[model samples]
Target: MSSKVSLLISIILHAGVAFAQGPAFERTPLFILEKNRNPENIMVIYTQLDSECRVQKKRGGSEKVVFDFYWLMKRKDFKQVNPIIKKEIRSRLELLPSNDTHSFSVMMNDLKELDTDIKDFKLIVTANKKKGNCVTESILKLGESDQNKKVKLESIYAESKGFLIPTVISVTVNGIDAETGAKVTRKYMKK
Candidate 1:
């Protein structure tokens, strides 16, 4: 009887750990930009969300929910590619506006448009920085699979010299279901 009890406890512990880890998601690359200018600068950003809701009762006979958000950033030199690094820093400060409402979807669309215009410029090429300021927002919705399960996400981007670069990403998970929603995770680097 004791051996059976021990095995049962071990199984329960392992199941708890697995449930804590939540569902799995893969990272997706979004954009890459290449510039041959003096003092080139490159930036990349990533964001993710994890959450779980349990229907367990506490000692007081009440249930609770849990959620979390994570964000990360990575940067590299422009000279790493085939082109030699020109001047390191062009303008002392590359101003990023704050008024525009930037998001992953908007940035994706803007990048597509910029890619077309970039082909036209040659030698000392300068792409127009994104116009206006930058803004971020988030929203959450429940899923049909589980009443306790839901997905939440937020996206942010900036306009620089006519080029739109994504900057901030936020995500939220809720409810009892594991799978949530779709998100863009790719990094943009200039060639």
Candidate 2:
């Protein structure tokens, strides 16, 4: 066979292999909200649990990877937070088109329309206060009506230092507040 024929065959076989694999997402998270382990003090999502997802839909046949860039921060590193958040957002927005990843971003805060991307898609968060031993529970769903609601994937936490232990972070969402800016706010007991 000619060299050209052999090269074409090689390319076809490589393409087939690539197509077989799918997009990759890590169980590792850039950051996490953890419950205080003290038995006396239970964990309650003080103000509200904001759950927002920034989705980058798959394109073509490329199996993209979840974007998980790790970094460290000191308390003083961020003097004014809004500016920082905005700058970070702007940077990421520019890079989104260049990324070969199928990633989602979780954002929060009282910026009013800070997180309405999923408003039409919608997610319901229930912040049930802890009672006796029942413990506080939270649920996340997509869509407004129960018929349209879809359960999210079971989330696993990622830890380092001690180990890359997978941890699950749960937050209760009372509702999605378009006006208040605080979506899924919970009442926590302090005593």
Task: Choose the strongest candidate by lDDT.
Answer: 2
Q: Which stretches of candidate 2 lie over 4 Å from their true place?
A: 1-62, 69-71, 75-182, 186-191
lDDT of 2 by residue, 1-191 (tens): 56643443343223211111112221122221223232222111111111222222334763332322221122111122245533543342222222412233233321222222234322122222123111111123334433333333222121112223322233322333333333333321211
Taking the tens digit of each residue's C-alpha lDDT, what string does model 1 give over 1-191? 36643442333223211111122221111122222222133321111212211111223532211111111212222122222211111111112222211222111233333322222111110111123211112222232333422222222223334323332222112112225344423222232
Provide C-alpha RMSD values for all models, in order.
19.8, 21.5
TM-score of each: 0.17, 0.21
Clashes of 1: 31
Off by over 4 Å in 1: 1-34, 38-40, 51-104, 107-191
TM for candidate 2 is 0.21
